[model samples]
Target: MTKAQIGLIGLGTMGSNLALNIAEKGHAVAVYNRTASKTGAFFENAADLRERIVPCATLAEFVAQIRPPRPVVLMVQAGKAVDEQIAALREHLEAGDMIIDAGNANFRDTIRRFGELEGSGLTFVGMGVSGGEEGARHGPSIMVGGAQEAWRQIEPILTDIAARFQGEPCAAWLGEGGAGHFVKTIHNGIEYADMQMIAEIYGLLRDGAGLSAGEMATIFQRWNSGPLESYLVEITAEVLRASDGATGGPLVDAILDRAGQKGTGRWAAVEAQLMGIPATTIETAVAARSLSAERDLRLKAQGAYADALPTGRLVADEAFIRDLEHALLAAKLAAYAQGFAVMEEASTEFRWDLPLGTVARIWRAGCIIRSQFLSEIAAAYDQAREPAHLLLMPAFVDTMTMASPALRRVVARGVEAGLPVPALAAALTWFDAFRQGRGTANLIQGQRDFFGAHGFERVDAQGDHHGAWSK
Candidate 1:
């Protein structure tokens, strides 16, 4: 029997689909899972694809079945489970063999794992696989980070199975160590912000404009044809248009108001804070999710403030709807700008030489945040060696200029209606601050100097000086 070209551990949703995708792409894959029953079940239903799968009952058998300098893919749970699997794999694997972790792990853990494997002669690839279950079964966007030699061996299979934008495969080697996972984290952060912005617009249309879910679905479908065309928007339209079979009503109306998260968005927000980059849009989105989780507190607060709260719809018109669309677009741009800015700072900090254009291009398909907007982002990054900021790009500059007024109008309207639009408000504030030559931070420095001995920098003179508040 021919030796399997690759080995896969964890026969869960992502791993099983990815393994099928790899096998379908004509690479013989060795499959193993913690539970032998799952492995048995997977191969039993493999159909014609079973010819390419080498099922192993033991880790030793799994490691032995792969060819020399083997590439093993792990799709286990993140954190302790990943570490445990690595330790087990290391016991059975030889030097120069590669272990590819295709999980939503924190980048710091990826970095540490890379360091841990340094002297062992084994290669570790911290890959970020996006596009969830269906993408895994068909094609997903893959970001790889590891030794170039190992990448060369893994590239063909990954590229063949990845979703394509135009003629280019939606997969690439981002950088070394943790870079791929870091990019993935930021991608999710941007997703959170995008969803939050969409939800805010939906709220405005639903509550203020008093439009039904079907009406909002139609609006989202229309938006998908324009600048806001994206996977999330497309899914939102589908979700809005879906019917509750039991209730015979729009499915969205019957769904819970609370939102759930899986930590990547919060990780991105925390990393942005640690890097001292002002990613307010992403921050606000994280905050929005956290706020959503406080359902009981919100219910109590609503009752407590019922008499004081303003109650009534704004009776929105065509003009308001148009402005809301532009507002959502503008806010989305700001959110993407912030996410990419976080990536820029992270790249510099980690010395990862990440190609922003390639990053944008890879995100154009297969990823949750895939959008027509990312195509424009790719163009912007391609236009320069390094852009000062995404918003500074000429095309983006024009778009923001044209759309910001509508954003301001939407935000103001939401505020007056007593509706919460935190993400939108944050994006507008971030844009305003980004464009400002001077800021109020000088006053903060003054307060700091008056309390402690913290000094402030002078705009006129080239020195940091502390003022004597007594004098």
Candidate 2:
């Protein structure tokens, strides 16, 4: 195995943490940042924080400091800045080297960059690293896209710094060309849906069960040990239970109700729609957040609807738990459905050899959207060449049957309490639509044929039962 000498750029929160992580693992890493003070500060901090690290003042110097066929990681802001930084560094780099964009880059740009860099011996990997700043400090889920040969050379150091999932690193050659960023974009989309689901559960507790944040946190903590256990759920409880310092109000109330989103979530939703994949939960979550931002509109409606609202008893814990569990499960199902849908669409579109089973296995740890159910998802993917049949598996169907009782009631309460329950609804809708509504007219096929001049099959094609619509 070849020991890799890595170079990193952008020493902000993410970059600095990554540099520190690399150094802590005992790799010879040289980092460069445009800002002189940060570069000086990082070296001094690294020596104090942990020794055995190197820093470079300029991109050229950083390139010269490391050996040839160098692996330089650009952890700058996505979009043009990534290009500018890479362009500057190119002055010192030569053919046969590698440049990695570790930002939330647009996938199309990833492909364009790959095309531009081709024929030069240099390799380009549009890499997506997830787990946020915390993930950078410990280990992050890495989605690598580019030449497979480049991946082979870089895997050693990447594996060392990546999160462990099922005894393997949370890093994979996601697919060809732009697949890394594509995967990362979808990863973020899934992240948006996951968070919205968590937020809905809190609303259910507050509105339906009349529980405080502390109480909701306890329920989340309780769910952590079961099949529903996950990193997000664990964090959900902690964040909810937290309190504001001065006002001493519930921390949930103290924080902004309006969720923040980068363009990645929108990208996933748009791509999903283009691929004709039903990203209902993901879509709904995005819409819900956008709507939430109109706080003034909500205030106006508050007075309008207060008088018309019906009086209802707040359900006790035992009863509320039944419905809450169902809502959570349903939302979880929807979230996973959107994630898999995006994955399927991207795999087909990009023609990348994405292993669905492997993908699920890699998501089992370190990633923001990891879940306890990923192991089962991996098994299902392994059982079938296609992951679309996942919901049909008898074992999984049975597991869902066991889980559904709780989710059904939870969803009901969520709906009744006026909670934003897109995740729950999305999950249930997919399951119901899949199980109960197969062979039904989708209108999608007909619409596609009409606009794109594609053909649609009649309900009874050979029986001459065609509809009377003119082309």
Candidate 3:
């Protein structure tokens, strides 16, 4: 029997890291990059990699190194580079060979690529690799897509290089077509909202409580012991505590408020709306980023329309804090509900059995966006139904009842101090929507404008079809 081999297409940060991991697992690796020297040096530097690294001069030779039915992973840039790599290697790869695009590709492209490659007997897979450079260099979360037959050929190697989520390896066969990239895309989307929520909470502590940077960090440190503990929130406090270079004050204030994103968040939210799932919180968070970019304009708008901020207080005690933590958990559950709702809709819409529980487990480690909350989400998927409310479930409802008041108090404090808290707002909105018997929005009108351009229900079904009053 021959040693299984993996061919890595690029040698940049992500690619290099992936190569290191693949080779580290004691498998034969055929490394290739457009720039020959860097690829040569990368493999040359590794004392153990000397035997594994078969540096090929050309794409044909690169494809030739794998014993038979080669599995080559292209971790190059998105867009044209993906097509370029495929074009260069098409003639070289044999019929049974497998091609994995580990790049952050648009999901639609993956779907199209699947069609192009399937007829030729060459398998195409779009895998989403999370856990940046370090994760790749060691172990990372790997989401795989395309045919099940293609996945079986490389599952061993993927398992070797993937991180552990819960007890299982952080790798899963996500299904055919663009399923892998779709999962990864929605993963990033949920990540966007999660980070925004933490940021909103941090901002609230700063502006609302009139607390200094160090003071806010203390609160986070305290929260870490409870349900609110998370990698991002932990980092938030560390960043807040760091000193500025010039003023020696907190470094956070010096950083720009305008955040940059890769567009997945907005894409997820938009797709959610199209699929008729609720994603208002995530959408609003994206909008909040846009609003932050226009801080000056927003300030001017505030001048045009003035209003008083709201306020609330929670009595300080261990019991209250515990209750607040429960609320935080509940809110987080709601946040995830919106995100999963999007994924669930996409999975059904696209005809893939995405293994929702497995996704939740894979997100528990190595990925940039993993949290303890994902553990709960995995169980939720095990029992969830279409359009089901996670928060309304018995377990979640009990948790919410215990903590919603305290969470609301904390949010009230933010409102009083004029701090931004979109995460909490999204959570609250989801909560109210779930708990309330009647939704006030002209749902019919919403359906018409976005779906069919129909009229809105003004008050009730009996009242009237609301059009802008001709006044």
Candidate 4:
């Protein structure tokens, strides 16, 4: 039999779907699973595609099934499982073979893994695969980070399997080391902020504007045709429109308020804080998710403050609803700006020389946060000179100028209505701070200097200086 072109070593939903995708694309793939039984099950499910799938019972057999100078994809759980799989593969594989980690790994861990595999005669690729289960089965946005040579070897297959925006594939070698994973982390962070802002708008519409799920679903579906057009918004409409088979009510109404996260959002916030960058929107979203998990405490607190809750209902008029849409767009722009800023800082700090424009281009399709706005971001970066910050770009400047008032009004209304709008509020505050020429940090500097002799920068002078104070 002809040797498989690539090998996969997991049979979970993502792994199986990805394997099928590869096989369907005319690349013969060898597949394996830790449990062994899953390998058989996956092969059976492949059915027509089984002709191109080689299911192996053991690690050595799986490795042997692939052609020499192999590129094997590791779809196992991140962290220890990844390390274990690499170690096991190392024992069976020879020089010139490659191992690709297609999990949502911490970039630091990806960098460390690179260090571990150094001089081992094996190449390692840190790849970020986004777009959930369906994307994996069809096409996903593939972010690859490693040696250019390794990328060259796998680019054809990756590009073939990636989603396209206007016929351009959504896959690229972003940079070396953990660049792909770092970009993915920032992507998820933006996704968190985006989802939180959408949920906040939903809360305002439901409670303050007295809109039912179906009514809100109609509004969201309409918004999806405008500036806020995105996969998240599209799905929000679908989710709201869904009816619960159990109760015959809107499916969204039956769901728990608590949201779950898998750490990438927090990682994005933590990395931003470490880098001294203000990712307040992402941080606020993370905090909101944590607060959501405190269900019992929230219940008690709600009861204790029931009478104090604001009862003012918003005017559900055409003009006010348009403001809500504009507000969401403005806040969404802020979140993307912060995410891109984080990536820009990471690129410089890591010496990755990340192609920011390419990043935006790849994100225009196949990812959870895919949207029309990303195309504008790509165009903004494609200019003769890239803007220092996303919001500084002329196109974005015009957008913010036109939409910020609506954002301010929505935030003020939400606050007065006693609805939680943390993410939206954070975005507005961050945008305000970003555009301000002078901030109140001077007072903080003076207080620090007086209290701890930390000193402060003098605007009139070149160097830091101490302030005279009576202690």
Candidate 5:
């Protein structure tokens, strides 16, 4: 009897779809689930995949079905469940076999796991599989990071199953030891920032410009045809256009304003702070989500200030609308600049030789943040091993020069109108700070030295000296 090509553990939506996707590619799959019923149900519903899959009743049976140096993917929940599964699988697997973890795991946890299996003769892989349920069923952008030997063995299979961009696979070996997941986490962070900016724009249009949901949908649709074309923008158009079947109104109008998040975005922000990288856009995005969660508090606060708030509205003419679009594009570029900067900092700090260009290429498709703008990013990194800064790139500099005026105007209008535009405002501020040759930080350093004798570096001299302000 011949052995299956690979094995998959867990039969949840992602796991099951991935299994079927593999099987559909004409590869034999051995699948198992913690609950045997899920395995049974998977096979029952997926009749087309029946012939290609080897359903295993137990963990030992699953491991036994694969060939030597076998690769088994674990799609279990992140954290403790991952540890438990690894421990259980280790008892039955042979030396030199590979374990692929295809879950949204914290990168630090992945590094620890890789360390644990270093001398055990088993290869451990932490892969970031993005594109959600549909992408898993068809093709996802697969970010592989772990043992190099293990990656070489599984690269063919991974590349075959990933989404394609202009005939290129969206799968790539990012780096060693958790680099894939780290990139994915940062990807989510950028996503959070992108979304918050979009939401803020929606608020600006609705409250400031008095555009209805349908009108906003049309605007988003138009934006999707321009440089802002992206999965998020496309989806925003669909979301805005959707109707509440029962209420006969736009679906977005009925939905709650609160936004929920998993931990990836927060982790990205926290990691940035730890590394001393300024990821203000991502941080503001996380802050926006937290603020949104305080719905009742916001309502009470709004009521308290309702009487004193100024009544101001933005112009809804074509000139103003065009300005809003330019502002959004500029802010979005700033957000990406901050996100990739964090990646660059982490790559240096962690000693991971991350290919920033490849990261941009893989993200072009089969990711939540897929956009037309990413190709420009890929081009920028491709031109220079590492550009001094994304904004300094000629294309981005031109965009900023043209669009920043609008961003400034929009932000100013939001402030005067009592609308919170944290992400957008943060993006503009970051851009401004980045372009500043001489920042107000000299005052900050002086104050720090005065208060705590921390010391400050001089522009003219080499030594760090403390300032005595009292004298």
Candidate 6:
């Protein structure tokens, strides 16, 4: 029998779906799972595609099923599990076989993995797969980072399995080393900010405006048809509109307020801080998640401050509702601008030469943050003279100018209504700082110079100068 074209380890949700996707695209795939029963079950469930799936129970059998110059995808857990699988696979694989880690791994770990695999006559690819299980079974956005030559070998299969925006595939070779995972981290960071901003808007409508869950659903549905249209907004409406079967109430009301995270958002914030980039909205979103986890403490604090808390409520009239929509759009733009900026700086820092436009284009379809807004970002980068920053682009400048007042009004009103809008507020503040010609950082520099003797850059002079603080 002819050997399989490629192999995948891990028969979990993501891996199984991706395997089926590859098979559907007409490639024979060899699949394996450490749990031998899972391998059997996956093969049994392949149905008509069974002919295209080579299910292997052992590492030796898995490696043997794929032809030489083989490319194998490992969709296992992000950390040590991945290391263990790679180690096991190395024992049975030949020199030229490539290992593609398709997990939400820290870029630092990915970089280290590259070092460990170097000079071993084996190729390694760190790929970021997004869009969740549904996208995996159908088409997810794929970001591949590895040797350009190794990328060429796996490009066809990835492109075939990736979601398409218009006629273009949402899969691309981003850069070398950990660039793909780094980009995915920023994607999740932006996703956290986007979700937090949406939740803030929901709180404003629910608490401030006294809207019912059904009413909020209608509003979100309406937004989905407009400029704010995206997968997340669409799902937000779906979630709000759902009913709890057990209680006959809004399903969302039954769900706990606490949100859980898998650390990608925190990694994004950490990397930004390390690079001295201002990802304020992302940072605020991560902080919000941590705060959300303190449910008991929050309850106690709320009770303690109940009497002193503001009782002001917002009037969700036609004009105010329109402002909310624009406000969301404006804040989302700022968050995305910050995410892309972080990616740009990371690209420079790692010497990855990441194709920023391709990143935006891929995100326009299969990723969690997929939006029409990303198309505008892709266009911004495609211009002959790409702006130094995303917000500096001429088109974005016009957008920000037009929508900023709405954002300001919404944030100010939400604050008065005692609504927590940290992500939105952070976006506004970041935008304000970005547009300012001269900021208040001079005082901070002076303070640092006074106490720590840290040098400050002089506006008038060419060199660093010290403030006369001894007196």
Lowest summed lDDT across 10 adjacent residues in model 5 is found at: 384-393
Clashes in model 6: which pairs? none
Ranking by TM-score: 4, 6, 1, 5, 2, 3
For residue 119, give model 5's deviation from the true position in Å: 0.9
lDDT of each: 0.93, 0.79, 0.77, 0.94, 0.91, 0.93
Q: Candidate 2: give its CA RMSD in angstroms.
A: 3.2
- Looking at model 5, residue 270 earns an lDDT score of 97
What does each candidate score in C-alpha RMSD?
A: 1.2, 3.2, 4.4, 0.9, 1.3, 1.1
What candidate 5 gets wrong by more than 4 Å, as runs, is: 385-387
Residue by residue across 42-141, what tens digits does model 3's lDDT show?
Answer: 8778676667667776787787777778899999998889999998889888888888999988888898888887688788899999988878988898
Write one digit per residue (lDDT tens) for candidate 5, span 37-82.
8898898888877888898999989998998889999999999999
Candidate 4 on 1-471: residue-level lDDT in tens?
799999998899999999999999999999999998999988988889999999999998998899999999999998899999898899999989999999999999999999999999999999999998988999999999999999999998999889899999999999999999999999999999999999999999998988999999999999999999999999999999999999999999999999999999999999999998899999999999999999999999999999999999998799999999999999999999999898889898999999989999999888999998998898888882744799999899999999999999999999999999999999999999998999999999999999999999888999889987998
lDDT of 1 by residue, 28-140 (tens): 99999999999999999999999999999999999999998899999999999999999999899998899999999999999999999889979999999999998898889
Model 3 clash count equals: 3
Better of 2 and 6 by TM-score: 6
| TM, every model | 0.98, 0.91, 0.85, 0.99, 0.97, 0.98
What is the descending lDDT order? Answer: 4, 6, 1, 5, 2, 3
lDDT of 6 by residue, 1-471 (tens): 589999999999999999999999999999999999999999999999999999998989999999998899999999999999999988988899999999999999999999999998899999999999999999999998888999899999999999999989999999999999999999999999999999999999999999999999999999999989999999999999999999999999999999999999999999999999999999999999999999999999999999988999898899998999999999999999899889999998999988988899999888899987888888889882743798888898999898999999999998887889999999999999988999999999999999998989988789889888864
lDDT for 433 in candidate 5 is 88
**Could you tell me which 10 consecutive residues in candidate 6 have the lowest summed lDDT?**
379-388
Residue 332 lDDT (model 1): 94
Off by over 4 Å in 3: 1-4, 44-50, 243-250, 294-327, 383-387, 441-471
